[model samples]
Target: MDDGCNQVNPSAALIDLRPVTVLDSITELQTADRHKVAVTGSHGGLASGRHALAHGVAAVIFNDAGVGLNGAGTRSLADLDRWGVPAAVVSHLSARIGDGRDTMRSGVVSACNGTAQALGVRPGHSCLAAVAALRTSAAHAQETDTAGFASASGQVGPHHVVILDSASLIGPDAAGSVAVTGSHGGLPGRRAARALKHPARFAAFNDAGVGKDQAGIARLEVLDSQGVPAVTVRHDSAEIGDGSSTLRSGVVSYANSLAIRSGARAGASLIEVIRRLPE
Candidate 1:
């Protein structure tokens, strides 16, 4: 096989480059009809590959397009827009979507804190991470006002790029109040515990199972602890309450993950899943 561009010998035709950081050379080869990229990980160093894509490559492949990706210099989705490249995410967590996901079908936009993750160019994951990598990049950018999300120039300020879970754990020091959407069991329990500590407003969205699970029970505990209130009903049922009064107004929101589980893939999209969140 021939290795794309550099021709050392006939046997060296099959050029296999793994764990490479610089995508300029590879892109040059593919542009010159010397090489082709079949598949790649959505992990760190994806931005380098994006650099190649920006130059007009054939196609790009990604595996873990979820969270914790490190592009070469691209900081967030807005940054990728400047490069004129779209990233495909293969993960579930919300934060991943907030960072690298482009306008592509499988892409997403997520938020995070500057304490955990890092910023890069490509569309995999950022090295920046929060306690659990839950917050989205937009949320992080809003919280810090860092140019990391600046669409003007790549030169941004110094701030943490980590993804945080929810305001339940910490106070409302980050982006606008984040809404939690997931199975109300595992991490929800922990989030509820955190909410009990501070008097912050919140909302929950659970499916049939989650609405009646241990995590749901824990969330109720948090509400009670914080002196908040809640009411749960089947997907079809509706309740009437005053929307104007803060007391009548809810701090926490809940939904059934299984309510409309057909159209969505394994993990539901933020637009679809959390759409019911109070505006």
Candidate 2:
């Protein structure tokens, strides 16, 4: 395997030859990084993979996200192989789920497509190792602002609805408001309180295909412990980076105890669920 497992020495030569881009989210993908290693903190789901492909990244590494719900997480590996893109995923347990730097710093490869394997990238190697091994692969790039979303706020009856492209957009002002975000409902680093820094009246996230151990919906239970109402939209029903799509097209896939008590239920439209929230 040309995985460069033998290259334990951090050579300034190798790093300068093929500088890879590390992104906290694939949403931060830039046009300059095309045809270079793109290591992202995003889930290894097909949606995320497709996003990278659209930008023409050389190779991508993502978190496996517990390989949830029929393997929707990391499903892109197989597809990337078909598309001839070298793709691999790190174990969910290796680092924080949505933080790209963490993924590269400590993430361990859990799987890689045949294309990556053919290039000597494989499971058990560190993400950085995988990055170095595949640096020579043809990379590609695209562009988006670092903020990642055009956030807005409005009212729904007595409740204020804050539509954000990413959960990271939730501000202190949303403490008593409602948040509809395009981010997935996973407990990054398993931090419960970090689910929503603000005590929003209610919140919603994408289900990321409800991957392993139901990790995609893990945020709901964790949010419950914070005494907050939360729900997740089904991944297929909405685009993951468009908060407007989350509201208009998302279907409630799961609800926390507080959400259920507040009239939220699975298999309901998010609009219907929001309408049912108590004043």
Candidate 3:
């Protein structure tokens, strides 16, 4: 059966729709090839994220918004960084922008929804610049095709991070944005960091505070402590989802406000975020 991404067996890749469950079906996906891999499941959170990191798949396509967009999803991005794998997230959320803007986009990486936007860096800029430019980016992607694995959850890579959120999950007042960072190649000179239109610090994190995204920061902090450089996004929505309770518009709005604030606060220490990424 050809699934949306032309999968030979979509069922084989699908994980159970439960909490605290991991996908054993695609465990060997990394060893198979480095092609774009999409992981879909109701409970594809921390456990599944670890598996994806172990496999070191080229890109991760999350089917569910919660799985790869929230706390667990951020951890997955950190894991990918540790493995030196470029990652991309796709979802129905808005992009993260530096100018305190939360815009929305449909298919491609939107300013309000893109990783760079989340970091607050202007488009076509370096990775480090983006993170420094903006305080934080929030939300996860909902659905669509774009560079990397974009989900309503979020996406990260060697030089990029993006977040998207759904109106239902967050709220109407919730803003969307996109963030981008340009590669500085290596050790950026003070002048270079300032002059280069876009200079990105290697995404890394280093902190024990637990930060905002649950276990996600652990990995980034580990790396940031070593000065690997990093960037991150965090968003709070009124209604994350209606796992047991139904999601509502009001709930979503409140949730998004919290998430955006959290992301903004965290954006300041992007390098530290990468250093703290999981090992």
Q: Is candidate 1 or candidate 2 better by TM-score?
A: 2
Best by lDDT: 2
Candidate 3 lDDT over residue span 1-279, tens digit each: 211222112342343211111121223243443333333221122333444555434334221122222343334444443443333332213211110111112211212223323233332332222222221222222232222322232333332332222111222221222221211111111122221122223321111112112322332333234433333333222111211111111111111122233332333433233223333
Q: How many clashes in each structure? A: 60, 14, 119
Stretches of model 1 off by over 4 angstroms after superposition: 1-192, 201-226, 230-279
Model 1 TM-score? Answer: 0.23
Segments in model 2 whose C-alpha atoms lie over 4 Å from true places = 1-38, 44-60, 63-130, 137-147
Highest-scoring model, TM-score:
2
TM-score of each: 0.23, 0.64, 0.24
Weakest ten-residue segment in model 2 by summed lDDT: 139-148
Pick by TM-score: 2 or 3, better one:
2
Q: In lDDT terms, how accurate is model 1?
A: 0.26
Candidate 2 per-residue lDDT over residues 38-132, each given as its tens digit: 89877776667777777778889998766654575677899777767889999877766666777888889999998888767878998888887
Residue-level lDDT for 120 in candidate 1 = 27
Worst 10 residues of 1 by lDDT: 147-156
